[model samples]
Target: MQEEEPRGWRPAVAALPAAAAALVYAWARWCFGGAAPPSPAVAVAGGAVLVLGASAAYALSVRGAGGLFGALFLALGLLSTVAATERTAARAETATCVVREVHAETEASFGEGGAEKTVYRLALDCPGGRPGELKDAPSPLSRGAEVRIAYDPRGRLSAVPAGAARPWKPALSALLLLALAAVLAAHRRRPQP
Candidate 1:
């Protein structure tokens, strides 16, 4: 009689390490307030850890859904980490700017406890004749009011009222990680063949 191969939850088990690494990376970036990009050494080390975790998961998983999950986790982890790092780094540069224009938009949400939300955007005349815009301004800005702006070295706007609030990048990353964990858990609980 032919023997059936043993079925295991290797894929789900494997995802944990990579997920944990991503969480740590997210936390570190948040701690720095996205003010500075991670040093090259830190970036390289983080990449290495992510790669190793994905590789291990890939090797241990089955050739179908398990492999797909491993790859998905790896890709998401890489994207989130790189995005957080780059965005934070870019925002490290700062300049004092004068508001030239302000625009506001109101949107209605349909989700549970739906409500109307307003977003304010600002156009600024920065020092040295540099033009900049602030998306999601924390408060309404008066035209000609002086304010601090964070930007990339390339002169692109990054943040308004520097360090006023933490960016949403980390929160999005955490949500993605949480969804991945839930999927992995469900996969692990499936009946083995």
Candidate 2:
């Protein structure tokens, strides 16, 4: 005999993939945004963990009835990539600004210690006087030096050196979304009981 299902469980179940995807996205952003270690081993480990976590989430959600959880997670990933790519195209302007400050950056060195690697950031005078920072700042950059950078007026993200191409994120995301759509369509065309 089949036991009756509990009340109000499906909604939470449906949200699992979304929550997992969000966590993965945040982790990835942190890794690429220079807070995490920049070593190849660290990057590979992070990528492996993300894949395994997403797979686990899909398995838990799809074991019930519909197999749509995979598509939902994939869609969320694609959306994030698209959003990042959009900033490169819209409201980005090239301008020369005075370097107001220079900051030395490094990964969070916890228990492990041997040597420290350093990166640089240059703060610039933006339109509204709020100031924007440029990551991967050149070694020669110094306060009061004129530097050209690409900045978004809205300041959703930090500035970058001018003439950077951001094509990989959206391209990879589009490919994944297209593949998922094709697979879903094929699955739906099969006959049901």
Give all candidates' CA lDDT scores.
0.61, 0.57
TM-score per candidate: 0.56, 0.45
Q: Show the lowest summed lDDT stretch of 10 residues, model 1.
A: 182-191
Task: Give per-residue lDDT, candidate 2, residue 22.
Answer: 60
Q: In model 2, where is the ten-residue run with the lowest total lDDT?
A: 184-193
Residue-pair clashes per candidate: 0, 0
lDDT of 2 at 43: 54
lDDT of 2 by residue, 1-193 (tens): 4544355445554454445556555555554444333465675577667656655555454442234545554555545543454434443567788888899887565566855667888878865654477787756587898877776565545566776646577656645653553344333322232
What would the TM-score be for candidate 2 when compared with the true structure?
0.45
lDDT of 1 by residue, 106-131 (tens): 98999989998899999988877654
Model 2: how far residue 69 lies from native, Å: 6.6
Query: In candidate 1, which residue ranges exceed 4 Å CA deviation?
Result: 1-13, 16-87, 155-157, 165-192
Best by TM-score: 1
| Clash count in backbone of candidate 1 | 0
